[model samples]
Target: MSETTALSSLKIEEVPQKLQIKNYFDLKKYPFEHEALFKREKVTSVIGILNEIEPYAKDWLKNKITSAQKSAYKPEASVISEGSYNVILENGAVFKPAAIIGFSGSKDTHTIYIRKGASVIGANIYLNQGDIYVGEGTVIEPGTAIKGPVILGKNNEIRQGAYFRGNIIIGNNCVIKGELKNVLMMNDCQFPHTCYVGDSVLGYCTHFGNQATSANFGIMGGIISKTITLKIDDKNYDLNRNKIGIIMGDYAQVGCNAVSDPGTFLLPYTIVYSLVRIPKGIYGPNVILKNKSFEKGITEVASLKI
Candidate 1:
């Protein structure tokens, strides 16, 4: 089938009544194209928006960078830059940023945009291929390797050993210490410590404990389709996407070492206990899900999407 014909056959929706979920999943500021986890309905929406504004943003950023390189950008005393990416130094600041230490990029595939008050403290941190855009007042610590097409908003903490691949968007005042690819984190969210958040979308102030993970793809896999379903109780909601991971709503918290099954969708203020293996379904807005490990579950990380 043709692409348009195939997309016309797909529809994504949320089933709140299945898990008895009510007043969960807000729609207001959602479907932001920069975000990774969004309703399948937003797919076409993003394409249209990107077609309009992406070129403009690129051109504007390029010209601004060129001007900054020629006239205004002044490297701080602590920096050890390779001089590959352009730097924009906003003047009249009280304090300057720390050393850029080490950074890498793909050939014309990405650019690194760092706003003022952004700091990269310590060593072994590298920004590799693709564009990495850090908004104002963000801090990145040591041992992290970030690839581009990632957008980080203001006042965030990109802590140690944080690994990122392409297509991730993080909002303001957030913390990310996990391994993420194609993930979207709303404002005030935290992914502190060892975790894998792939193809997921986390809402405001949602946080994960150490070692929390999202199992994104099929385990017994052959050909993985992006269309999947969310089963809550006897009801099934067609997600219309094959590679859906965790879609967590606002104020949700997962305890240490929690492993969510593929396509786990939790609503606002939901809490899952430590070492729990979350089932594949949509959960409540104000519920507490306590769980214990079965020990019979096989390790599923080997089948993860790259």
Candidate 2:
């Protein structure tokens, strides 16, 4: 599909009149590569916004890198190699491969491919047991169970005891901590603690606070439904994906013990306070939280807090 058509399919929405594009820009750097692929015409403006955001935008920008990969064609080398240590993409990208060791289950049953420079240590780790592809430069620590059709991009560190199932695509420079489950992390993201991130897509450089979690299902226990889209200027771009978790813009952070409701959209540079239970779209760069009045068991206080 054409770029414009793709963007249009995302159902672009206009920013609130009270909000400024510069504010959004200042909060998070747009993913230039994804912009080039999906919104090239506006890339110049997006880059301008990045310049305006400066140093703070790096993490946000990195998170966007994965989106670019989504639109790019996968090279043949990545598709057919087995147990190869090095993967040379058609574009001449080079990566080191590692060995898949220590599996108690049937090796033939699981098809695990470790690109060059990637390493998987520890025993009882299941691979391709269900269709798993660990990309170049990735490291899977011991005690990890990776279910199939999962794509782990370059330079990712999967810590021990992490159980990831389903269709997960992890991008570059990410760190997956133990005790974490079913998460689709985009580029450069990190979840380094007991975080339950299920059925979600995390943007680049977004970090989850320890114990931070998101609820991806309803009380009835069916698949959670969320709408995916892009917001440019004042338009909403619609992406026709039925299962979506959170569309966190770059550099968004969820504090420890924070719980995000399903279908939440956290704009870049947004910070969720610790132990906060936030609804969808409650997070934005310039959001101000203030307590106007408070009542306590022994006292009452009125305060304006940011």
Candidate 3:
């Protein structure tokens, strides 16, 4: 097989319109060893970034399913399709689904679409509405709630009690369990346990430690202040959106219980230490964001006189 074919196989379909910001992300600075990684992720669109890069969410249930069958979206186990959407299998991977799973769509009815090798384990799970797409080798643990218009890519683990809302796409090889909405995650991302990530786009290999959160709403309640105005070199710029979360690049690790102010943009390899409240700004790449108390800064514990 040609190198291009191999590269394109794992690539998420690209879209136009780069991320709209000056010097926010320098893709050239991404320390990726493989050219394939750059090819898959190198999008410069600033306007509606996810909407432009998101290849799967544009099509409705019917279209996504058909595309999944042809693509590498493989399901190891058999899919017990029992819902409103039609299931079609043509020249594709073999799916010997072990058990007949079901959907309880009383509150929000959804069409569950699972590719070959994907497993939905145990009972007590519910998908409220929209179409659910489970990619190859992915596992949805018991007691998870997924409200649809969502897609899970290859080799992902959606742990127990993970709740999801509409307009979401989880990329390949991710381990995530959280309350989320309108989020797009890239490959090798690990985010689990008690985080509320809303209206955000996380890059490759990003991990959010326990109880960390991206506070999307910058506006204080009851007063009509909604837009997130960012200050760069004393010039304030508007993102032109009310709901904006942390836009973290690849290999960014958020320490436990850290809270990101709205419109926080973290570049690649940024490490935020525990309990650090990241301010709203365009943080350049490879920054170690940590909270330093004034007392700690003033004097060291060992040096201070008792």
Candidate 4:
């Protein structure tokens, strides 16, 4: 089929009703709580709203950061830093043998902000690249590297070996030990162990087992389709984006070592079995997704309670 013909065949509204972002996430929860930008009625896509809000959010945060810089204090003896940064010691923050580098080898001058009661601990923990804001009482453990344009909420536990590439916004009380890039994680989510989550949005209390991966690109690359297209019920919905990972709903859980293809969407409370290679599409609100093998795709599903 001609490219235009194939593209014309795809429609956005054809996306299943169950796959709607509202079904998986509730904006009343963390990160977006009390935000007027999200509460507006006309904006339907949470993903789109998230992107739209980024610049404004960053500016708001930057203003606060600049204000806070007036009271910034020097780091302790063990801490090493370069370029420009600030550490606010309102409730007592700590950095144990950490290095903060504020330049990204370019014109952009990255700034690091460690809020009150936060801790960056490690033999060689590194924070660099773009602007970084670590929330109150958050603990970043050993061997973790956080590149910036990242915002984290209160009391998050970022364990050892965690590597955050960039463009991440995480809410309060998340437990993370993985590689993340361009992702938004709502409150109380747990990605406990090594995993790769890129270009994704994870809803409240979502959990990813060890080694779980949200693949964000097509294996075929740009050779065929430039953007990711989701097929639902044999109909195509062109997302018009090249790098979309999983869009998980509230309380969703993906088992250990499972892989979710690009543009995967899981509704609330969905549970995926271990070792399953979930096909790129929408699935359940309360169901168990199981696969006999990666090549076989999803072969079985059962109703789940909670």
Best by TM-score: 4
lDDT of 3 by residue, 192-233 (tens): 787989888887789999999999886583477656655544
Q: Candidate 2: TM-score?
A: 0.56
Give the true-structure RMSD of model 2: 11.1
Candidate 3 overall lDDT versus native: 0.62
lDDT of 1 by residue, 1-306 (tens): 212223223332322343221233454644333332332233342112222223333444455445544324555666565535544435422223343322344455235566677765553223334355677888877767666556778888888888876667777888889898777677878787889988776777889999999988778545544455554444444555566678787788888998998778777878887887887876666777764345455322111121
Worst 10 residues of 3 by lDDT: 297-306
Expressed as tens digits, the lDDT of each residue in 1-306 for candidate 2 is 423223322222442422222333232343422222223233222212222221222233334332333223232442322331211122332322222322354454433444557775552323433445556777877666665445677888888767675455566888887343334456788887777776554666888878887775544435545544444454454433333355465677778887776556666666776766765443565342222234322111122235
Which pairs of residues collide in candidate 1? 225-242, 226-241, 226-242, 227-241, 227-242
lDDT of 4 by residue, 1-306 (tens): 423223323233533565455667777554454245444443345444435435544665677577774455665676676765544444577756477765545564545667789987772433454577788999988888887777888999999899988777888999999999888788899998999998888888999999999999889876776877666556665566688888898889999999999888888888999988888878888999998665554457789975
User: Between which residue pairs do clashes occur in model 4?
Assistant: none
The all-Cα superposition gives candidate 1 an RMSD in Å to the true structure of 7.8
Candidate 3 ranges beyond 4 A from true positions? 1-47, 50-56, 67-110, 123-128, 219-222, 295-306
Candidate 4's C-alpha runs over 4 A off are 1-19, 29-31, 34-43, 49-57, 72-80, 104-108, 123-128, 222-225, 293-295
As a whole number from 0 to 100, the lDDT of residue 255 in candidate 4 is 97
- Give RMSD to native, each candidate: 7.8, 11.1, 10.8, 3.8
Model 3, residue 170: distance off in Å is 1.2
State each model's CA lDDT, in order.
0.61, 0.50, 0.62, 0.73
- Taking all chains together, each candidate's TM-score versus the true structure is 0.69, 0.56, 0.69, 0.83
